[model samples]
Target: MRPVRLSVVTAAAAVTALAAVTGCAEKGDAKGGHGAIAVTAKDDSCEVSAEEFPAGHVQLDIENKGSKVTEVYILFPDDRIVTERENIGPGTRASLTAEVKAGDYAIVCKPGMTGDGIRRQVKATGGTVAKRSPEMDEAVAEYRTYVQQQADETLPKVKVFTDAVRAGDIEAAKKAYADSRIGWERTEPVAESFGDIDPKVDLREDGVADLEPGQEWSGWHRLEKALWQDGKLGPEATAFADTLDKDLADWVKRVGTAEITPTSMANGAKELLDEVATGKVTGEEERYSHTDLVDFKANVEGAQKSYELLKPVAVKNDAALVAELDKQFAALNALLDKYRADKSTYVFTSYDKVAEPQRKELSDGVNALAEPLSKLAATVVK
Candidate 1:
């Protein structure tokens, strides 16, 4: 969707608060449960006190008192750095624990929020540091291999659906389209690595439809007619196609460029959930401009394309998969109607400005669909 647009004020506030917190301390006595450093953010900067930390492992407690979201990063002498939890919203704190060696290091808040929070330099002395063992290295390597295998298996299935469509076999096209939903579901855990692109919104709920009995299917037929037959695609239709292409390209690109590790996806998912939380909490109607709606629509379409790509894999294995997908499709349509009604009735100024609980309910409902839909991807392509 349209990149999340934060006001300059909000951005500055978050950055400043983060900076202040990171600068606070180097080491502190183990408190509560572990060796911990407490840092607090105020305004746009964070305040960190200096301290001596145990060398083997350390924990950082980041407390935010501002009105924006913030992230923390730790920089080391050898250019090795660790990004702490991100999108820590207002009034919340996150603790990050890591094993660190004795060395000079810097801590800073991420940019884009109050420019960048403060930075503090610290030196760890005295204790023995843990070194990576061969076993750990081997585990990491094995995980990488597994991710590559998954991607390799997924891409070809996606290609099958697209190739079928390109061949213009209406029946094969429909079956292939239905089959491709598995591809997206299969790669979702991997796909989550891509930042800000929500698979639930971008791939699960939108795209070209199967030649089946439904309004969604008919919508796809109408689009094809307008594009290939009439040779006159509307702005909306053109935009939808573009998103479909982009979503596919993104998946393929990740196969080579992305790390495909669980950590990558987990980190991305945290950021996404944070953004969704921020959007839900702020209730800023102005944030959902016309451009935002257009982006939202594109994301919905991307999710649809992903469904189309994996549908064949799903239907080939279980007819029930199609039924479930159709159910979600219908649910999304109903949600859209609710949003429209709320907008027309001035229920909360705008769709984005709906009550926090309502917004969260909507986001959670959509996200829940991803789990079952994702299971189809694990089934081998038939």
Candidate 2:
């Protein structure tokens, strides 16, 4: 995670090692680039100092000349918004770096930090020079493919939920609901990038930072209200489910292109644990269904997937720390798994079923997982 202190956490190579395992590493090692790419942001245009450059560890030095806040994106032809630095206030400079391969990509500057702004083409001509191993590269690729699969998997489950609602089967809809959200919650960050569609599909009713006043609330929460609070799946409820299903399908189609860095993935795992601690443990999510356990378990699965993919890289960097991370993750998952009552019955079906002691256990488990997962980002991301 980008901490309270920035600039100080330079992805310095870890100095420590696990005895008889991955050997020792040197500390104070510099990460990522030898030179910075100069970029200037103006009212409606973007200027890249170098139209052509070597492909490798490069930082974009963005100087905002615009009166408004600006952001820059390096967009690849494959639809990945590979890297970005956001909220560069007027007359200020901000930097973001990315490891890139030799390829052509579009550079976009978003002034006012709103719509996609001026775009220009840029090319990379040389080999990559980042200090990353093939093990790390292979892991990231596998993780990316897994994320894409999660998107694909979530869509069909959305249909199951929608179909149950459309059939006016409240019990069936309720059953399908929790299962449908697992894959969605796992790959949530990708869905969140889709602007209008994210709020439409999964935004909790209370989470309204970007919500426009007077806008009607819809999506899972909307259906949640009908199924749980209203205790019936009526025409309006079915219609809303249909809407959510469509949006979910759209997200499944669009999400494969999302940019997910190792740092973001590590941070995302920790954030999911935070979500579990703050919301799931408190009975905040699944307000009606009380199926918080399902979401909680799914979140752990997501976080675990993220960690496993980066496990080799982390072990190579700091073996003992990664071992701790692995142990904590296993503990949390084990605790959740212990509560299962067959395929249909997950750990605690409802928050009300959990005794005070059990709730504390869940909360403590999340905290243990969170601590190490949070540190994983700094250990690996440069």
Candidate 3:
């Protein structure tokens, strides 16, 4: 998801934070056990405890002493994210974990949640860490397969949507819209990992300010505004739809090569919850279509899928956390079920139809799940 630009959350009862990528390390005892690194985030500086560590399953224990909510990233020398933890509020502390091979890397902290951020040089200085347990490797393999499957399924649905838009069939296009987004929403972190794809296909108009010059806002939301808000489907909209199809096709082809790790999967699950809380719950995501619940359900499903894949290792590390996660997922799912028009279909009541009190319940459900979910990466890596 894009960095939040709107002040809409102040009016809604939900978590006020930007959606971000993966996280690392154990709590306390930050003297570098279990591949731990400590970081202090301030308004003007990002201070990392050490620049070197062994390869594999690294954890970052982060403390934000800054006034603004911050974001932290462990990046490849090329600036691709190895893992990240975002929306760490003032005075809060968070732990993020990731696996890495021997290489030079950077730890970046973005205070106020904007710009390229302050950078600190770091390195993983040894050969590949010992192989994890067979089950852990299997979990990563299974998640990679799941992510690829979602990407593969998305291209065909997106084509149907694009074709409908081109035909100027308003009802058909509207019907296909939510279906097209489900697969993308389910595995958004994977798409986002590609760096350029999400901004092209998922960036909303409000996020335009975050883009560099010459980068135009295109893809689903642009077409969404045309079909719902503008109520017009001209050649321009059709052309953009075709472009969206190509961008998504690119995502489908590239997702298989995306980095997948046990910690990344665990952190990705938390990212989905953040997606729901920041976008879906506030109804900012599907502003024109009012289909936020469709995306909401898909986000929850994606989070649950990641959790389930990692539950075996996580349960071994912390049985209580697994139980809380299971409970929270079920609770959230049940709440979403209330709006389902039918159990067999993806159909749901439009988000605009939801009342304020109901929205609060949804927000509370998301926050409840998000807290425990944030610990998943560290738990699994432990």
Candidate 4:
């Protein structure tokens, strides 16, 4: 869907005002001999002057003064401290405090809102802030082993569900399908750490129109609709369900055989994210349509599966790491909620009516989470 041009213009004006207020940084002989840094969001960019500061207790006066919501993050080499102010409205400001030590740091802002939104290579000459410790390599390895085991155990049930459908056993097929779905959902917390990997394409919505012609059905809901007419299937419905069952089984087998690993997850996620971004920016036809939202949800479920497989490993080695994983998972769920809500607004509506700024905001929100999600996949093991 494309956003209207007027929204973009409004967003640009908001960004400009934000930048004007945040572009100042002054070096004064304060208590700690440190300087005050100002950050502004403007013209769809974040501008920071003298981003680098000496190692000492520093105060960041972040002014949103923009039309949209914003967040500011201070990234250390190994750890990060973030402050978010939601819906800052217009002509508003927020503040953040940090005692950062001497090292490389990055200041980043929300997506599509202005400036590079990132200030890098800030040096700290004095400060007693704590340094971040490196994650243990062994912990990562242990997590990978667990993920493989979970995949082995759960992927096969998808086949069982499909097989039941092919055998014309509607009751069994439903039970099996539900069980498999539960397994996938249970695994989603960890699977999300891996990135975008769809377990199987569900052809539930397309019904049995092309079944006799050997064309593929596209969603699981289609099959369900065929089977349940006024809550019960007749004799003719049996054959239709059987055909769907066979197709599902075939999809399960194919997905099971496909290779799934951290590297593949990273690459696939990057590719999908790029596609989503391009689709949003250029208003081009998307590779995946709204009908594919269920499939995307399933892919996220797969990530949860990976998470289930790895949580034990994380807990055994580092409690803090597990906590961080949980935080990432929560953030991911929040992102999905926002996506669904925005997507619902666009459903059954013409693209031209939707505001461009809204589209950009949605795209930016997804991208904001994607980097961290991809990184989590690389870091997670088992």
Which candidate ranks first by TM-score, i.e. highest? 3
| Clash counts for all predictions | 42, 1, 7, 48
Off by over 4 Å in 4: 1-177, 183-201, 204-219, 227-230, 248-256, 267-301, 304-325, 331-371, 376-382
lDDT of each: 0.43, 0.67, 0.80, 0.41
**TM-score, structure 2 vs. true:** 0.66
| lDDT of the structure predicted as candidate 3 | 0.80
RMSD to native for every prediction?
15.1, 10.0, 6.7, 16.0
lDDT per residue (tens digit) for residues 129-170 in model 3: 556788889998998899989888888898889999999988
Q: Residue pairs in steric clash, candidate 3?
A: 22-84, 23-96, 23-97, 24-96, 24-97, 25-59, 25-96
221-304: candidate 2 lDDT, tens digit per residue: 778878898988788887798788777777877766555666556655665665677578888777788888888888788878
Model 2 alpha-carbon miss at residue 129, Å: 8.5
- What would the TM-scores of all predictions be? 0.39, 0.66, 0.88, 0.33
lDDT per residue (tens digit) for residues 283-368 in model 4: 34222222223333444445544454545544654566557656755665565555454644312222344467855664665555
Lowest-sum lDDT 10-residue window in model 3: 8-17
Residues 244-331, model 1: lDDT tens digits: 4555666566545443222223232233323333332343211322112222222333344445444544466678867786687557
Backbone clashes in model 2, listed as residue pairs? 339-347
For model 2, the stretches where C-alpha displacement exceeds 4 angstroms are 1-132, 208-210, 343-347
Error of 3 at 363 (Å): 1.3
